[model samples]
Target: MERILLQLSYNGADFQGFQIQNEGRTVQYELERILKRMHKDFIRIHPSSRTDKGVHALMQYVHFDTTLSLPTNKWQHAFNSALPDDIYINEVTKINADFHSRYDCVGKAYRYKVYKAPHRDVLKRGIETHITETLDTRKMNEAAQYFIGTHDFTSFCSAKTEIENKERTMYKFEVIETDTGYEFFVIGSGFLYNMVRIMVHFLMDVGRGKRQGSEIPAIIAASDRTKAGKTAPAEGLYLEKIYLSPEELTQDIPKGTTITLKPTRRQLTQQS
Candidate 1:
């Protein structure tokens, strides 16, 4: 009955998305299959967030229950040995029973890379989106600052969202110019469906002079999906990290059996 938290990272080029689906392959489905093969039982891996198709994850958190007495290192070794090269489990730890990878997360960060050059590199085709339009990085960066703070981000979300709450806190949102492209990074306490992508789309539009940068505030005020820009391509987005405050990571003792032969305190500290 012990909970095992897995640090997951994947390319996300070939998979449909993070969740298990009936139509095509997915990260969760593959992980679940490996888990069933290893334990001979269905093990559910609860992901921190559900990324859209073609979206990548540099670091993703997932948790599952395991009854095996094997150590965390053994679990990691077993899982990695079975998983394909494209998908890797960076770390595994025995977390507090009450800790949830998704619900307990305090924030999520994502990065969208746009290649602005005319020539495209074949190597980066799957990782970065190519756009030849000349952009004003300064204006885009200025526009990004408007998104920082708590707001009703209904206008930036996808029309397909079924979630009730569109209110989310944008702690940090910035656009940085790179050697070959521009990177749009956003950190938020929560996000609605395709919120980051839509935000990026607006910024791109602003960079291209299609819309004034100040229109962002009006769009936020409007809270209408049509007021925002288009949703950016999924290939350019990556789930950078998920944060859980130290307080949230701590255990709240409950009426449950504790494992006796768990790793030492020092080893457990390294897990975080």
Candidate 2:
């Protein structure tokens, strides 16, 4: 058997989440079902991250072992032919047996889209969060700067989260304004359950003048969940990218494939 990695994207409005559940449809379940039909056996996949319900992904990663030896480029086409419309495989590559999609990831970036128009966009329903109130992106950016460092994120996580260690490093956090709304982007070493949503909620409070930008440090230091703002709805969140070491990702890469490593701040600015 050869280990294979797949890069894919999905719209999560209809699925329960990325993982399999006993009672609901999920991305993993659908992907595995298609694989089983194609390979004529049970096939399991390991995803890089577990996204909550209604959370979308632009560049999710997964790895699985398969006996079939289809050409790498053809693998994406073959998988997309059988997979549901909401989920699409973008690329496939062979990898070393030891390569892992989750553990090997060094960083991840997530984006939260907030629609601040007087009326909601009918086309964006179930995809973007609608807020009727105007949001101050400058204040939100100021508040977000406090999150850019290593700290215990207990206050920003869900109460139901079971992880004992809440410390994680935030490498980048920024709020950018668009014509109709705001975009909150966060890149971190790791994140606790609901951490990004809570952070966004806090930034919203700051933007609405309910909280001060300077108050963020104390709130983070408090480590009390009650001190944090409410969790933002999952529909607005998207897993934008996952970062892996160049060496780990280059193994057995397909010819003609161009991998773009994690972008620097300048690159992001240029793209913006």
Candidate 3:
């Protein structure tokens, strides 16, 4: 058997989530179902990250082992032909048995889009978070800057998260103006569950003049969930990219202010 890695993107509006559940349709379930039909046996896949319901992905990675005769170059076409239109396989390659989609990931980039205007863009209804109020992107940018560098993100994560270690490094957090309004881009070594969504909500509050941009440091230090506002809705969030190597992580993220993301905790422990 050989290991295959597939890079994919999906419109998650109709998906229950990335992971499979007892009920409801899911991205994993669809991919696995197609694979089972092709291989005539189940082929388990490990994903780089799990996105919540109504979220989207521009670039996501998954790896699986198979004994099938599919060549590396043709894997993408084969998978794309079988996958639903909402889910597309962008690329595929063969990798070493030691390579892992999740554990080997060094960094990830996520973007949250907002469409602020008097009139709604019906075309982008489920694609962006729409708000009718004027927003101060400058203030949002100022607040986002405070998130740069390593910190305990207990206050920024969902209370439902079970991860024991709350510390993660934020390489860069930027607010860039787009045609639709603004997109909040975050590059990090890793993130706690709902961390980006939570931070975006706090930044939105700052943009609305409900809070000061200068308060972010104190809020982060508090380690209190109440300090951060409610999680931003998932429809605006997109998994922009996944970086498996330190070099790959450094080259991407346009207009990034920070230099490098710290290695994952597992990498640090292994080195020690």
Clashes of each: 0, 0, 0
In candidate 1, stretches whose alpha carbon ends up further than 4 angstroms from where it belongs are 246-272
Better of 1 and 2 by lDDT: 2
Weakest 10 consecutive residues, lDDT, candidate 3?
263-272
lDDT of each: 0.82, 0.84, 0.85
Ranking by TM-score: 3, 1, 2
The better-scoring model by lDDT among 1 and 3 is 3
User: Which one is best on lDDT?
Assistant: 3
Best by TM-score: 3
Query: In lDDT terms, how accurate is model 3?
Result: 0.85
Candidate 3 regions exceeding 4 Å error are 253-272
**Candidate 1: which pairs clash?**
none
lDDT at 217, model 3: 86
Candidate 1, lDDT over the whole model: 0.82
**Per-residue alpha-carbon lDDT of candidate 1 for residues 28-140, written as tens digits (9 for 90 to 100):** 99899988987899989998899988999998989898887778888889889988887899988788877777776766889999998778878887799999877898999
For model 1, the run of ten residues with the poorest summed lDDT: 259-268
Better of 2 and 3 by TM-score: 3
Write the residue-wise lDDT of candidate 3 on 23-111 in tens digits: 88899999999889988999899999998888999999998999886776677877888888899998887777777889888889999
Candidate 3 Cα deviation (angstroms), residue 1? 1.1
Question: Quick one: ranking by lDDT, best first?
Answer: 3, 2, 1
Taking all chains together, each candidate's TM-score versus the true structure is: 0.89, 0.89, 0.92
